[model samples]
Target: MKIYHNQLTKTLAQGFIPVWLVFGDEPWQKDNSLSTIKAAAQQQGFSELIRFNTESGFDWQQLMDEYQSMSLFASQRIIEVEFSTTKVGDAGNKALVALAERLSEDIQHKHYANDVIFIFHGDKLDGPSANKKWFKLFSQIGCYLPLYDVELKSMSHWINQQCQTLNLNLAPELTQLLIELFEGNLLALAQELQKLSLLFNQSLITLEQAEQLVIKQAKFNPFQVVDSLLLGDCGKCIAMLDQLQQEGIAPAKIIWALHKEISQLYNMLNQLEQGESINQLYKQYRIWDKRKPLYQHALTHIKLPDVKQAMIRIADIDLLSKTSSEFNVFILLADLCITLYHGDKTQALSLKYG
Candidate 1:
């Protein structure tokens, strides 16, 4: 059966399934869900926990042996299998299907002791993975919980809930600031809230306090890099990119910022070329009053052809980042910044890494 994150507790109250598959890309949600499961399992006297990571060249026989052997430390055991990616090879696919079939057979034959639970977790599941035999079998006999990130439109509510969890009351302005700054990065948002809770001891946080704490805390973020790009400051843009790298920010976040800016510019240019009013477009796009000049500068300096090329290049960069671990995405990102600002890919590449 498929279960949502909200239903996990109720679902666990009924009984424990032989297998549980909790998977997603959201770190905060994934961590919370696993913790909930672990707590529930421990409450049910599943005392011994054995964990395995399916890294490259992992031996399936080891897992099989561990599953078949009895736990020496406790009466019950929980086996956790973590996958780094969904690209589990043919061997893994067969092993999972075989285990699912055995679980189903054991339950049907009343041979299951209800003493051992298997939990598998990993990255987001793609469409093709849903149709795999192993996924279907596991869902039929157990539960598959897939977590999704909160949408930007509903981020304020999420932030409010998180603040309530931390026993901290956030003023309206501070909440809005957090939504704007940490929308996609929930881990960072949680850390900041914990910091606020520690400093103020769960007191209500005012807008001024938040700004004084958060705004001055960082000199570079993905949003700032895109802001510099929109202002046509290639030097500052590349410098921020360097700082972001040195600060250990993920390249995916940088890609998201760049893609968002280029996509908005492309949409604005398309609407303008269609004879739409710039003022109406600005309102339609929800451009902030303080940031209208940045959009205006981008609209004037960036043309449709350049925007189109950038859209394609960013997509390529995103794909390459996901597929090729060794590829330095920052190089292409820097090249993209120069191309978008200067409108010359050849010159951009030649001047930087040529």
Candidate 2:
């Protein structure tokens, strides 16, 4: 049966399913679901775990062999397979189908019902792959969970739920602030909540406290750099870029944040140019009242063409960072930010940076 990440806890309460396929790009949900399943399995006497990663050249037959083989140390065992990609080849597809068939037989006969649990974890499976024979077979016989990223509309509720889990009390305004600061990054939000729990120790956290704490933590996040860039602060953007590089943050992450904001800005600019109401667009995008001025300033100073060119430069930087070792992504990123900030006046400045 197919279920969502939110359904896992209630499903586990009913009983442990023998086979599970958990796949998603959302790291927090995927990891949480796996932890819940593993805990449930352990409680049901799955004491031994055999893990396999489906890296290149992995033998599909080995999984079959392991499943068929009995555990020596423990009566019940869990077989966990982690695949980086959903595209298991022909041999793997056959092996998985065969394994699912065996599990179905076991379920029908009530044989080895509690002795073995199979889990397949990986990135999100595309729509076409979900209709494949093996995947369909597994779904018929076991639980298939496809996790998704938390949408911005539901982020505050998610934050509140997480705060409850951590025994931290955050006011509505504080919760909204946290959501804005994290910018839809669940892992970072979770970490910040964990930190708040440590510091506050079950006490109610005020907005002032949250502001102070999040600002300190914000030093390491790429969002700050993106904010600086969008606000057209070239000096602050360059400084934050340097800080991120010094702190060992990946260039791809910084590039991704910038690309996302710029893409949104480009879209918003087009909508405004087409005579759409700014207030309506802001509401549609869920832009907070405080952030309207930032968007307004950026739209006023930066041309739509400049935003488009910056996106192209971002793409180039991403490609060069991955494909070429000698190219300096940080320098390229700084150059892009300066170009976006200064537009046509960046010729001598871009040359100096280059």
Candidate 3:
């Protein structure tokens, strides 16, 4: 069965499955899900725990041997296999299929006879993973929980949910500030929430207090860069790019943000030129009231042709970043920033490619 992380608890309450496949890039979700499953299994008298970390030249026979081996004291057992990647070799594929057969036999014994639980976990899987014979067999008998990083649009809601758990009441502005500072790093957000819970003791956290106490987890996020670009703060934009590079934020992520915001501007600006109502376009794009002013400012300063040239430049940056390791992506990004800052007065194509 395919289940979400949020649904895991309810699913566990119904009954424990023969196996669980929790795979994702989100560390917190993967760790929490594993802990939840382990705790639940432990409560049900699956006291014996065995773990195997799969790597190069790992002996699959040992895993099978351990599963078949009877413990002297503990009646039930939980067998966990941690994978580095989803690419299990031919031997691993055969071993996992065989293990599934054993688990299926135990499932059929409705007497809950000789219960042996299996947990196979790894990082984010590709789409093709679902078709693998081992994955198919596991899904048929157990459950698969695939998790993704919380997106920027949903960060505020996620923070609110976390605050509720920590019993920390945040002022509205503090929530926004937290989103800006800790947008992509969930682990840092979790730690900060824990700190606030301890410090505030259920009191409301105002923006002032947050500013004074919260250590900036991220120096700046991509959204802030977009804001700087929109407002034509070329200096601030370049500085942010430098800090982001120093902080090891991926070039691809920064490029993605630039591309997204510029694409939106191009679309909106093109439509506005054709006599499309700005108000209607805002409604169509679901632009927030606060951001409407930014778009308006951008429309006054930026020409549609400039926006088209930017989209092409950003696409080139995206391709170079992916294909060439030696490509100086940040230099092009800085040039792009300057191009946007000057609007049509100084063209990017004339500056870099003309």
Q: What is the TM-score of each candidate against the true structure?
A: 0.66, 0.66, 0.71
Q: Rate the local accuracy (lDDT) of all candidates.
A: 0.82, 0.81, 0.83
Q: Give lDDT tens digits, candidate 1, residues 1-354.
A: 998877888999998788899989888788988988989999999999999999998887666778778878998999999987787889988988887888889899999899888889999999888788989998998899999776666788777877778888889988888876675577778788888999987678899877878742223568878878998998877777776777689999999988988998998999999999889988999888978988889888887887887887888889988888766788788878877856664443432242
Candidate 1: the clashing residue pairs are 1-139
Q: RMSD in angstroms, candidate 1?
A: 8.8
**Once model 2 is optimally superposed onto the true structure by TM-score, how far is the C-alpha of residue 335 displaced, in angstroms?**
13
Task: Supply the TM-score for candidate 3.
Answer: 0.71
Q: State the lDDT of candidate 2 residue by residue for 1-354, as single tens digits.
A: 988887889988987688899998777787788888999888888899999999999998888898888789899988999996789989888988888888788878887547878899999898888888888888887899998777657888888888779899887788878766565468777888898899998888899877877842223467767766777888878877876787689998988898899889989889999999888888989988867877878888889877877877788888888888776688888888987866566544432234
